[model samples]
Target: MEQHHPSLRSEALALLRSGVTNREVAEKLGVPRGTVGWWLHEDRKARGVVVAERPHNCPRCLSLPINRPAYAYLLGLYLGDGHIVAKGKQNHLSIYCCDGWPGLIDDAEDTMRKVLTGTNTGRRAKIGCTEVKSYSKHWTCLFPQHGPGMKHQRRIELSDWQQEIADGFPWELVRGLIHSDGCRFTNWTTRMVGGKRKRYEYPRYYFTNKSDDIRKIFTDTLDRLGVEWRTLARGSDPYNISIARRPSVALMDAHIGPKY
Candidate 1:
């Protein structure tokens, strides 16, 4: 049998424990990041290393209470496949609509109304609706109707009266609603595709949540909903978003009805 490179593996584990990034360790070891991860995994099995411990401080700002996952979820919504058309200086709101989305105009209006109203309590209300005025802004919906290069239809912006309704919501509720709305919108896009063609089209659906408040609400809601979520590392590269396929039907049965 060939001699095992235990020393190299130990060195890799040491590097990981020393706060060196996997990429850096991989570079030093002349191997892929996956290789580093594999080495660490093997060492964990052999040495009985437990790596699931939580940190005392936050991961994003690293202040306290460990709320980084929330920030990451929000950032993901901002960076993922979406459009941020010019709205005003130092201000732009992002919007994303998928091809498989049913009743595009209606959904957009529903989202707008929810963000403006601040509650998901009504019989016909969608989750993430909020009565927060500070967060509401003029947003346009662009969807393909007949074919390519179609004229983009503009949905009516929130009116002054609607703004009055939104202004009534508390600040915390407003933040929660916006974050939850982003999650709902992103989840909808992910589930929109169907059939054999879906294999090729499914992965394109994405959302980024760049705000601290947005991230916290999303992860907290996910935890409350008992859904699995992961935080991504910072980089210029894109991250994959995957939802558990087994839970889809059950989740839908719990909230969505035939009318939805």
Candidate 2:
């Protein structure tokens, strides 16, 4: 936004030449993207440097995962509880997971790193959650399922690539979605049999989302993994979709335990 030092200006151009996107260069240099763009063009022109038409980063460099476990996990997080904020010409993705389980946060962060490859990742603390965030216009490219308004208010479908990832690593995807917007906890019930009170406890999982499409993705992944889950309410509103079945609980526990 303000004047930059001569060295910093040259550094910005160098970053561009090295395959960094203009938006990223500006952010890294702590300046506006327009400034970086104009300065780079002027300097290149003055030096008789023939610049490529596209100021955007290289296609190969921007190529993130299309069908990988990390990408699938990130997708599930985005579908379940992530939001993208478009700030001017840049887009930032933020996914918040409850602090009750730090493993969820770790998984989300690891997924981001594995997918984004070389981008800067950011995090923040919320009242009851931890946030994993990153800024990149390419995020939109990675997640084509994004749309205007809330997920429940809009319909978004998975692309063919996403379907492939879902089919291949359904567990990671299912775990991410459930971790962000669902819960794995103990369920206890008491009954009077033959005038005696008895109590039984079992582990159950619940995945909740307002979007039918998102809910379907979660359940579909479970189905692929042979994990049983049920829609708690047929036509009425229950809290979330439930997976209280014993076999399902054991299967999930083997993979996704309480994220402590």
Per-candidate RMSD, Å: 22.8, 5.8
Candidate 2 colliding pairs, count: 0
| Candidate with best lDDT | 2
TM-score each candidate.
0.26, 0.75
After TM-score superposition, the amount by which residue 108's alpha carbon in candidate 2 deviates from its true location, in angstroms, is 1.7
Q: Per-residue lDDT tens digits of candidate 2, residues 1-260?
A: 57779999889888887989989998887889899888877978988998554343322345633438777788888988898887655677899988877777887877776776655678899999888897677677778777678888887798886788788888888877877788788899999988999997888998888788788888877888898877887577653789888888999989877666
Displacement of the residue 3 alpha carbon in candidate 1, Å = 87
Task: Give the C-alpha lDDT of model 1.
Answer: 0.38
* Best candidate according to TM-score: 2
> Which 10 successive residues of model 2 have the least lDDT summed?
52-61
